[model samples]
Target: MILCVRFLLDARGEALLPDLLGLLGELTPVVEAAPPDTALADVRGALRYFGRDAEQLAALVRVRALALHGVDCVIGAGPNPMLARMAAREAEPGVTRVVPGSADGIREFLDRKPVVALEGVGRSMARTLCTYGLDSVDRVAAAPLGTLQRILGAKAGREVYDKARGVDRGTVVRNAAARSIAAERPFSRDELDPSRHRRALLSLTEELGVRMRGSGQVCRSLALTVRYADRTGHTTLTRSRTLREPTAHSASLTEVAYAMYEALGLQRARVRAFALRAEGLGPAEQAARQLTFDPADDKARRLEAAADKARARFGERVVVPGALAA
Candidate 1:
C-alpha cells in the first residue's frame, strides 16, 4: 500500500522535513519526498514484516511524527498513489484515513464525489463536463468513452474516465525532494482579519528573502498555500506564479506573493495557516535581473541588501519593516 503524508512547516522547521521523512524511512525504504512538507511511502513489504495493516502502519507513523517532532500530519493509505493522496487531502490534521482496495469499496467511495474532486479535473474541465450533464464521478463513469473523448481530447478523456471509476495506475517513485525553500505561519486559531493575514505574509516573505539571499540562491517562482479552518475537505489551496525574472529580493518576492494572495480574494477567510515556497532555486549570481531605470527600485534593492547584512550581523528581528516591528 501507498501512504501519503503532508506537513506544513515554517522556516524554523526547515530541518524537520528530513527527520519526518526519516521516520517514514524507518517504516519503509520506498519513501518519496514531496517537499516543503509531504512524503509518500510504499509499505507493502513493511506491512508483511510488521504484521500490520496499512491503516495501523499509518497510525504508527502519525504517532511517531507527532511524538518526535511535535508535528501533526494528515495521512492517507490506499492501494495506489492517487487514492492515497486524495485520501490524505480528505483527512483532518493528525488523522489517518484509509481507502479500501476492493472494487466495490472504491466505487462507493468515489461515485457521489463531484468530478472536480478528482485530481486532474480543473475548473475548465469540470465546466465542460458539467455542460454535458456529467457533474459527478458516477456520471462520468457512466459516460461512453468515445463521447468523453470527443468532448475532451482522447488521452485526457481516457484518463478522466479511468479515474472516475477508481482506476489509478500510479506508483510511488522514490526520488529526492525538489529544491525549494519554504516559510510558514500558523495562527493560534482561525484568523479572520485581512490585516493579520498581510502581516503574516510580510513576515514570511522577509524570512524567505533573508534565507535565500544568505544562501546565495535566487528563486524563479513563488508558491502560496493557505490552509483553511474547515477540515472536512479542501483543506489547502495552492497557487504558484513564475516571476518575469529570478530574484532573491524581498520586495520582488513580496510583490508576487501579494498579487497571488489578492488573486485568492480570501477576505475574512478562516485561515489556519499560510505557507510560502520559493521554487526553482539556483545560484544568485547565475540569475539575470531585469534592467530597470527607476532609482527607487534600485534604492529598494540596495536597502534590501543592507537589511540582509544587518540581519546577518545583529539578528533577524534587529532589522525588520516598521509594520512588522509594530
Candidate 2:
C-alpha cells in the first residue's frame, strides 16, 4: 500500500527533515521527501516482507520516528498518495491513520469534510462553492464535473472534482531537490513604519541570498508575505522575466524582493512580521545569466561576492546592508 507520512516536526530548527528521512530509511527504501517537513513512503513491499499489514506497518514507522529521531509524525496510510496525504493531515501528530482502500472506506472518510479540505480547493474556490450552497465534500462529489470545471476554471475545477471523489493519480516522486530559499521574521513588538518593515524584508532577502549561494541555488520567482498587526496576512507573487543566474548575489535577490514589496503598496501599514520566499530555484549552472554591459550590475555582483566571503570568514551580521541596519 502507498503511504504518505507527514512529520510536523518542531518548527524551531531545520533538523526535522534530515532526522525524519533517516528514521524512514530504516523502514523502507521507497521514501520520497516532501518539503517543509513531510515524507511519503511506499510500504507495500515492506509490509509483506516484514509480515505486517498496512496499519501495523504505519504504526511501526511512527514509533521508530519518535523513538529514534525525537521527532513527532502523523502517518496516513492508504492505497494511493492523495488519500494518504489527506488522511495524515486530518490525524493528530504522533498518530497513524489508515484509510482502507475500499469504496465504503473512502466515502466514510470524505463524506463530512468541507469541500475546501480536498487538496485542490483553495479558500477562494471553497468560498465560491459555499456561495453556491455546496459546502461539503459530499455535495461537491455529487456535483457534475462539468459544472465544477466551469465554476473553478477548467483545470482547477477538474482537479477539485477528482479530489472530491477521492480520485488522485499522483505518484510519490522521491528525493526532489530543494527548490527555494525562504526566511521569516516575527517581530517582538508589532510596528507601524513601512520603512522599518522594508528594512526587515531587505535583511531577510540578503540572508536568503547568502544561504542560496552557499547551497548553489538561484531563484526565478519572488513571493512576499506580510503579517499585519491584526493577524491577517497577504501574499504577493511575482516572477523575474529572465532567469536569475545562479550566484548567491544579495543584490539580485534584493532587487526582485524589493520590487515585489513596492508593488504591494502597503503604505504606512501596521505589519507584525514579514517573510520572503524565493521560488523556482535551480542549480547555478542551469540558470542563464544575462550578459549585461551595465557596469552597476557587475559592480554590485562583485561587492556581493566580497560581502559573502567576509560573512563566511567571520559570522552572520558581519556585513549588514545599510538599509537593514536602519
Candidate 3:
C-alpha cells in the first residue's frame, strides 16, 4: 500500500515552510507543498530504501525538520492524503500519528470523528448535517447515500460519504515541487472595492508569472489567500485550483487568479491583503505545452518572451503591464 505523509507545522509569524520542505526532500523526492505551512509526501517508494515503516519515516522527517530549521511539525501517516490529513489533525504538535492500513483500522479511526472534521465539510454543511441528526462521523457513515444526497448536493454528498469510509482516490504527483513560490500585497487601508481586489490579484499574478518563467519553473496549481477585516476581527480566506496544464505564462496565471478571486464573491467585504502562490512546480522545460491553433496566443507568448529577455538584461522595471504602470 502507498503511504502519504501530512506534515503540519505552526507557521505563524515565520517563513520556514521552504526550509521544512527542503528537509522532507532528504527523505523523498515526491512532495506536494501545501502552504502557508503544510506539505504532503508520498513515501511508498522511500520506505523500501529507508528500511522503515511509514511511521518511522514520518518521525525521521519531523526530527530532521526540527533539527535543521528549529521547527516542530506534526506528521500523520496513512494510505492516502485524506487519511493522513485527518490523522494529523487528531495528533498533537511535534508528534507522529500513523493510521493502520487495514479496513478495520481505518473504519475505527474515522468513526469517532465529528461530522465537521470530514474534509470539505464546511461550517454551513456541518450545520445542515447536524440539523438532520447527522452530527458524528459514525452517524454520517451509517446514513444512506440517498439521504446524504438529499441533505447535501449530489457531488458533495458522494464525496463526504466516501470520505467517512476513509476512501480517497488521490495520488501524490511524482514531480510535485518541494517548494512553492508566494507573493502577498497588503492594502493601505481596509478597502472595500472589487476593482481594487482584482487589481491586486492582477499584480500578484504578473509578479508570480515573471518569477516562475525566470526560474525556468512552471506550476501545476495556484492558491489565493484573501485577508479581510470585519467588526469582530480580521480573518483570511484561502482557496486553490489545479490547472489542466502547467504554465508560467502571465495570461494563464492571471486568468486563474481572477477566477479564484471572483469565486470568493466578496462584494462588500473589507480587504486587508491579497496573497497568491504557485505550487507543485517543476522545470519549465519538462512541462508539456498543449498545441494551440490561436495565432493571438502564439503572438502573445512571443511578446512575453521578448519582454522577459529585456527584463533580464535591464531590470523588472523595464517591462510593466499598463494596469500596473505608475
* TM-scores of all predicted structures: 0.68, 0.71, 0.62
* Candidate no. 1 TM-score: 0.68
Better-scoring candidate (TM-score), 1 or 3: 1
- lDDT (tens digit, per residue) of candidate 2 on 100-173: 88988998899989887888678987999998888999999899989988888899888888888788988766
Which whole-number lDDT from 0 to 100 does residue 95 have in model 3? 64
Off by over 4 Å in 3: 1-19, 149-156, 177-181, 185-205, 209-274, 278-309, 312-315, 321-326
- 1, model 2: CA deviation in Å? 2.8
RMSD, one per candidate, in order? 5.8, 5.5, 6.3
| lDDT agreement with native, every candidate | 0.88, 0.76, 0.83
Clashes of 1: 0
Q: Which candidate's lDDT is highest? A: 1
Order the candidates by lDDT, highest first. Answer: 1, 3, 2
Give the alpha carbon lDDT tens digit for every residue of 133-229 in model 3.
9999999999999999988989999998988888898877755554578888889999898888888888999889999999999999999998899
Best by TM-score: 2
